[model samples]
Target: RSDPSSFCIISRLKIIKTDISLDGTKKVLFELEDGNRIESVLIPEKNHFTACISSQVGCAMGCKFCLTARQGFIRNLKSSEIINQVIQIRELLDQPEKLTNIVFMGMGEPLANFEAVKKAVNNIISPDALNFSRRRVTLSTCGLVPEIERLGKDLPINLAVSLNAGDDKTRNMLMPINKKYPLKKLIDTLKNFPLHKGRRITFEYILIRDINDRLSDATNLARLLKNIRAKINLIPFNRYDGSPFEEPDEKRILAFQDELIRKNYTVTIRKSKGADISAACGQLITGP
Candidate 1:
């Protein structure tokens, strides 16, 4: 037998609690060793489930529309902590094989914790490890330009950019990171990103009421992404307590989608899921 004192076994994340939404979405709260907590969401798709995992305890990028930003930046998670999220979530599934897709759209910015995310992603897609297909794994970012370039080179997984606004002024008001890397620089980087055959970059636009939901905004968005191979996902703003934003009405939402379709761009309106449990996009946050 090996020497027991050589190394100590680090404990995995403890599951604090799980909240299931009316629509079948499951939100799992995990407590880390340091007593900090993070959330991971299990979203039920047509035939499979998608796990939205966190890369950081809290977020540094203070996007006005995101609830996590309210918590401020805490720290980046270790690679093991990142990968453990997937392992733990999978174990909780009755049919674990049904969990097919993994999205880094939870609490923290994945690119902010680049090294750990890269390591976790490598393990995620490695045949001997998690065995997840690269095509099924997606990482979402709120426009971290340099990290975006680096990610393109290091990882070949699907990319989803959170492009909530069409113009710089509106974007600046929504996502503060836009102040450093403006819209022009972001679009240019995405245009140069290498993609495998039939793969297109996904642009996520959160349509907040009377803010970035106008038909003109949609027209501007179409112009902004004209040259890139892109598919747009229009996510209506998900509201939370003390949030200053509201979701646009269905009429306005469809009008925005119509404008993009009229411009020959493929778009889908993402249905707000798990809002009852606060597990929807931009609604994840953990207490200090």
Candidate 2:
């Protein structure tokens, strides 16, 4: 007979509500065991779906543009809580296998909860568990330098850095973490990060009007990442209540992308999805 103590019991997160955007992006609100809530997004792609999961209940990084930061830091989720998000979201799809990609860009800084995230990633890619391809899993961080170094050694999964500004002064105004890591030091770390052949690190730059959206900022960005193998994702700022930023005009956005493309950098403008339901990037927050 098996000992009861030897069996591990996993408590599931309750699905409190779900909101679907016209674009087919579904945002799920989950109630944790302690009644604290977190949200996840199911993004429908060309052929597959990507699950954007959260590593922490709320965020401590305090980026000026993020709504999640307004809630302040709650607690780091357990590895089971993190993995269960993917599992439950996948279960909602008609063809679960189509849910292939997993991105840690939902609510909090993933590296802030490194150990739990590492354990979750191991299970996410383990053949006997969730069995996801390493290439399809991406973890986005707000320039957590030491954790970024540790992550490279601990997991070979895809990495995406939220680099909203090219210079230290502007970055410090946007993400408070920049004050500690700074732009030069952070770039230096990324320059030495281990990447598999043909795999480039993704730099997520949120383009905010009159802030980090100027032509000079784009040039500085190009110069800053000149040495690293990088692909840029230009995200137009998604405005929420009380946000002090606005998205740049379409022409300005194009010019920003063009500057990078002219410099021989791969760039893509990430379309704002689920905004109608308040599920777009940096728009996630729990409670009414």
Candidate 3:
């Protein structure tokens, strides 16, 4: 058991409640150290919905573009804590449709908290309990290769790698994790990934101002995906205080998208919303 003193900041933090306008969309904040909290989102999208889940209290990935990393690592969230987010989302959801998707796209790296994440995933995906479809669930990683290869065999959940920089030189400076698990090793791991038919690994590329946001970067990106079945998601950077990054201009972002389209790769540009409320993907940190 962890010392409560370690969780003092979190313990003092009240799970400030919020009621949604949509059909039964309600949530509460989960606190961690240093007044840190993670927001649970039960988005009532179309027919099937999704739960935005957190794996760690804070992140050590320290990506130049992410707000969570700026907060620093507190600790890995327990399996029950991870499971609680889903249980709460399920309770508040009063719609006719079920929660079909669960994303490890919140505060911390899911793989960094491997055992807990894996167990929680198994709990929900098991034949009993919530019985969530593994395909609909996605675990986002900063390209943790060993864990990635491990998960490939252990579970059937989808994998999304944060590959913001197309090449190593830029990637290493942008995402420190890339220095350890470079593109070649990451892709090779993915190339051999045991994804079932109809499932393609996702590559999430965030576009920063003039940095890793060029045409050649997109071209080089295409070369890197040579034989891998991957979907590229280009996210325009979302700015927050203490983050040393700028969102790429609209024209530049689209031009980069067009280049990837020219390469005949399945490409998507995700326009981020909820930044005003600090609720966008990778922006969740402990706050009011």
Candidate 2 lDDT at 204 equals 97
Candidate 2: residue 176 Cα off by (Å): 0.7
Give the local distance difference test score of model 3: 0.79
lDDT of 2 by residue, 4-56 (tens): 12334377789999999999999999999999999999999999999999999
In terms of lDDT, which candidate is stronger, 1 or 3?
1
- Give one clash count per candidate, in the order shown: 0, 0, 2
lDDT of 3 by residue, 1-288 (tens): 122123212223235665353343334576644455677766656677788888888789988788777679988887767876776666566652377789888889899899999898987687555677787889999988999989998878999989987789999998999889899998899899997888898999999897899999999999999888889999988877777778888899999999999999999998654555656666776732
lDDT of 1: 0.92
Model 1, runs deviating above 4 Å: 1-10
- Indicate the residue-level lDDT of 271 in model 1: 86
> Residue 260, candidate 1: how far off, in angstroms?
0.2
Per residue, candidate 1 scores C-alpha lDDT tens digits across 1-288 of: 122123333558899999999999999999999989999999999999999999999999999999999999999999888888988888788888888899999999999999999999998888767888999999999999999999999999999999999999999999999999999999999999999999999999999998999989998999999989999999999999998899999999999999999999999999878999999999899974
Q: Candidates sorted by lDDT, descending order?
A: 2, 1, 3
Residue pairs that clash (backbone atoms under 3 angstroms), model 3: 36-286, 37-286
